[model samples]
Target: MKVGLYFGSFNPIHVGHLVIANHMAEYSDLDQVWFVVTPHNPFKKKNSLLDDYQRLEMVYRATKDYTKLKPSDIEFKLPQPNYTINTLAYLQDKYANFEFALIMGEDNLKSFHKWKNYDVILENHHVYVYPRISGNHIETQFDNHTKIHHIDAPVMELSSTFIRKAIKAGKNVKPMLPEFVWEYLDEMNFYK
Candidate 1:
């Protein structure tokens, strides 16, 4: 099976994330799309994130109904400040029968070159990119790269940071999240 790994902190899983993952699962050749909840991203600050399991629970709540979508806590066991390349290598070894790919936004593509062992990632796996509203310019080397496939998915500007801020401000951001996720967050009283 071909699986696409969609990595994120998922501070709280929202509809925008579901849309993209579902689009990749349904519109692309990937048999499954795993939401790899990162425990700690090297690029992001730890204080802004919820506990790893909480974020994973939110992802679970968001993807439970979709057979093609899954929530993975693979990074939780990995070393701190793990890189995508390391996770990719680990997954490749563990699931030898399954082919793994990456699902990313166009904005990430702009800085793809800066990632550790990026060339190795490109050499081993395919990258599926969805459009972003950001104005950043993508690297020229990736323009027509055979390993990279640009998917024409919807442009999702909705973000977890925006949702968190709204919740802290006592705004109704319920509609931005999945019903179950919203209920979980409401029960847990997160962000507020």
Candidate 2:
């Protein structure tokens, strides 16, 4: 099985995220897409994040009905300031039968060089790069790399940070969130 790992904090899973994952699972060569829920991302501030378990729960709620999509808490036990390379290496070793690839947007590719051991990832695994507005340099930089595939999946402006802000401001983010997620957020008064 070829699994694509879509890593994120998912402050809260939004429609945009679901759409991208769905597109990759259905249209791309990936057999399944796993949303690797990170406990802490080195690139993001910890103060703005919800509890790791809460974030993981939200991801579970958002993907409960999706058969090809899964929510993973793999980074929870590994270490602080979770690094993608470490998680990828661990998963690769544990699941030797299944092939793993990285799923990211073009925006991430622009900063891919900054990631720990990014060259190793590009060299060993295939990458599915979805289009994102304002993301450049991919065609110029990765054009020669066969593993880096550029896809035209639907782009969404929604983000977990934006959703959290809306919720804190008492805005209705129901349309941007899954039904179960909206229910959970309303009941728990999260991010308020």
What would the TM-scores of all predictions be? 0.94, 0.92
- The residue-by-residue lDDT of candidate 2 on 60-166, one tens digit each, is 99998999999999888797766788998899999999999999888777788888988998888999999886645445477668998887898788888888888
What are the per-residue Cα lDDT tens digits for candidate 1 across 50-108? 98899999999899899999999999999987899999989999999999999999988
**Poorly placed runs, candidate 2 (over 4 Å):** 41-45, 135-140
Model 1 misplacement above 4 A:
41-45, 134-139
- Model-by-model lDDT, in order? 0.92, 0.87
What is residue 32's positional error in candidate 1, in angstroms?
A: 0.4
Clashes of each: 0, 0
Q: Which candidate gets the maximum TM-score versus the true structure?
A: 1
- Candidate 2 global lDDT: 0.87
* Residue 166 miss distance in model 1 (angstroms): 0.5
